[model samples]
Target: MAKDHTDPIKDLRHNTAQPFEAARAMPPSVYMSDSFLNEELTHIFSKDWFCVGRADSLAEPGDYTTCELAGQPIIVIRDRDGALRAMSNVCLHRMSTLLHGRGKTRAIVCPYHAWTYNLDGSLRGAPGMTRNTGFCKDAYHLPEIRCEEWLGWVFICLNEDTPPVAEQLADVEDLVAGYDMTNYTETFFEEHVWDTNWKVLAENFMESYHLPVCHAGTIGGLSKLEDMVCPPGLPAFNYHTILKDDQLRIAMAHPSNDRLKGDERRTTFLLAIYPSLMITLTPGYFWYLSLHPKGPGQVHIRFGGGMSDDYAGDEDAQSNFEALKTLLDDVNVEDRGCTEKVYRGLCSDHAVPGHLSHLERPNYDFAQYLMARLEEGRAD
Candidate 1:
């Protein structure tokens, strides 16, 4: 349990229950305390189904990617049987990390002692353990982790009892049905270490309140506060809708699809899947961020997205993708500056919670989610 220096859990409980008009931001200690971060790693991230990357990226049977979640190294791979598998990346022989990064591998061989395992996590060979009596290689396979495929994305949970991703995200699937997201190809993917708390980035992506001020030169002109719609939070996710008076800049520059009609052509949806998945959907493009806490003040961000098949197959796709990537890069620069400064302010001795704006309803719901997870931890 986290030491109660500022009673943030109490504050979270109180403020999260208030009406939107009277709601308050979470306390700074929630973002600045190492103890609280450790608690979050155990109670929130580890126990939830967290997205890692697009399953489509591992199209081939032997493709794999390595990542760290809750300080535990993980390997997500597509086996020779075309099944997606997740397992502890630690070599069973000497506890060394088996894989360093993304690649195609026929077998996961521990460099330390040459102990080899098949892609399905079954032990294939042990270099010198044959001489030992009573040694059972069958019982020495790499430990498997809970993994699931939702839409076209890959999600893993450390806790075996966590609910299935499909069950939790059923409503979200309906909400985004028109987009045909499963067919969307990933044209861009990158990992970045940002100097901000994971929640800060999650909150930033969940609301459009900062668009006009923080993204003024880029996406700001396309937004109007009156047109924004903030929906109540769900048990598994929270979302807000942004109505554009005109087509998005990229949409205007490329061919539009007939599949989307009316407001779907001009509406944008920003959704935060509790704990760490943030997705933004527009008519022509979609992008997302999967956040992982590195410490109290650092977050590892997996950022990527791509155009819908309709637009991706367009003749102008190469040029439009370049333009869209440039625009997103600029927007990210603006966001990084603001979030880093906010983190610095959070460390101040005089830091305190402030009343939230109506546009920040998503942030309020996020507070609720955090409180619910903390309470669950206490119960356990």
Candidate 2:
């Protein structure tokens, strides 16, 4: 066997603890090591409450969506009784994945040996199992997973002992209350795989430092670094506020509402709920990215956004929606190019951690969250 290499966690531990003023980016190997990815899957994603999608998507009974959490296949269904339920999508009989995508389905049927389950994951039928005297359908429901709904979004936790989503994000809820997220209607949603480390994407969304450079031709001209203010990170999240230019399309399209006052009407909040969820809220609209690490070098992103009720029902909604989507598509193209290049740079032999700018406080907070979780895993 080849000699073992030093673990990247050693570097992560040292770099993460440094004071913010002297802090460096996480070690390059933290973005490229399989071992480090495994640790994150176990200590962070598996235990953290992460949003997958808005609950409104499952409005009708029988509507369901399938997703993967930290590599384990899961299905979220609106049961016949109008309750939302989440459970393993794996067929209990032969271990085949039961659902391929989202749609209306009376029941989940395995494409393999015809094993069937009710919307609530109860085994409804398992053809040929009748011959086995020891088989009991009632005892074999698809393993249930813990799930919660907050501000119209559905969150799931692989580890049942983790705190509830509401409890973890109470402060965030209060901060964005004026936007009325609970009533926001999702107008668009998509999934994409990015060729970059998951943390790279998360950090990219958390800061405005790159906006002036990477998005210069698009929304960059609207941003001013001196006007961006990053508040300290909390146990569950980090957020930054920035004043929006009234000339931007989004600002111009937003309807005035009594829910916000003074500068609140002109400010946008960008938040990263620890581990995965990224949310951007404005008086006019909101959008979010729920990130899932596919591995050290890839991320599965669930991107969705919506308009506040005031604008969602406006006569100009469709035209505005089309315009916003086009703008976002262009921004994503720019982000994908930049992040993929960063991943490539990190893989180079000369790659080394560099001191972070004050503008990168959110990235520093993310590093702290990573270190805390890794340490918790070690203690366990």
Candidate 3:
């Protein structure tokens, strides 16, 4: 039996504190503990810039998508003024959630009651409330959440104190400037619940070491494991690029694209944005995973992928994206199995964290990021 300890994850700091050559995986307790999950919810998720989806997806007025952060339910929508906005999804009157999923709505109506709210989240109608002198519709505007767009990706921050997304991710923008990532068109976006700690899936994405084995049936054959580069990570994010073979045409820069020369034209950047946004960006396409914890045992994931505009005029662009999406789906299936198995193994009393490989440098940095957030939580 595992002995109860005051801080099972305190060793996580120690493990991550070591040099990269000697770094170790975080203690398994970090993934299995309810207390740590609560701390992470209060500290990290509550204050981070969460990518809702691509801004272009909700381009027209009345278009909206609903999501939750930490424990707060939010609705990201285009209002009457054609502005992207984020507001509480919960009705002000009876507190029932206002929206269920992505769709167009001129007004948000609480299913539990007839209370209706305009696209701007201002209360429009309250049936049978005329008798209630205390009720003021004008005073019942749904509280707004902070929303921003960075490179066409929509992000929302619950903490008003956090810096703007673009300002924070400016360097990331600079690094991938050659790709014109904003021009990419989203092809698919879906949500799923995976039976694993969120961090397990995140770390899986952070390293390429597992690709040859875990993803062998899908992308494993394509990964240039020897050439992948994972230098020390930047504070806001971490990335490793794999050199694409000449045979993979779409992964390379287009003939029209002169911005990326030499190896930059053939490298695929796998970026891990902190607090759970994992992205794989190539010259011709991109995919991402935005994660949220259902609890200590499960993770809620938003999976999306798209094609670069370089292929916009090509007759085969749709077919290429379809194939890419299928391959990505297979990759996701492999990842799910690996991460879930890792989580299940973590429950064993004999399970112990092992040393990290050189390729897992991002995983080490990720651990550092987590501890940093936890300390910030403590300070507050």
* Candidate number of the best lDDT: 3
lDDT of 3: 0.89
The TM-score values for the models, in the order shown, are 0.94, 0.96, 0.97
Candidate 2 regions with alpha-carbon error over 4 angstroms: 1-4, 252-256
Error of 3 at 300 (Å): 0.4
Q: Of models 1 and 3, which has the larger lDDT?
A: 3
As for TM-score, the candidate ahead, 1 or 2, is: 2
Best TM-score among the predictions, by candidate number: 3
- In the range 225-306, model 1's lDDT, one tens digit per residue, is 8899997899999999987664455542124465667777777889899889998877677889999998888999999988
Collision count of model 3: 0
Q: In angstroms, how far off is 274's CA in candidate 3? A: 0.7
Consecutive 10-residue window with the lowest summed lDDT within model 2: 248-257
Candidate 3 residue lDDT tens string, 106-219: 789999987999988888998999898888889989999999988989999999999899888888999999999898888899999999999999999999999989988988
Residue 340 miss distance in model 3 (angstroms): 0.6
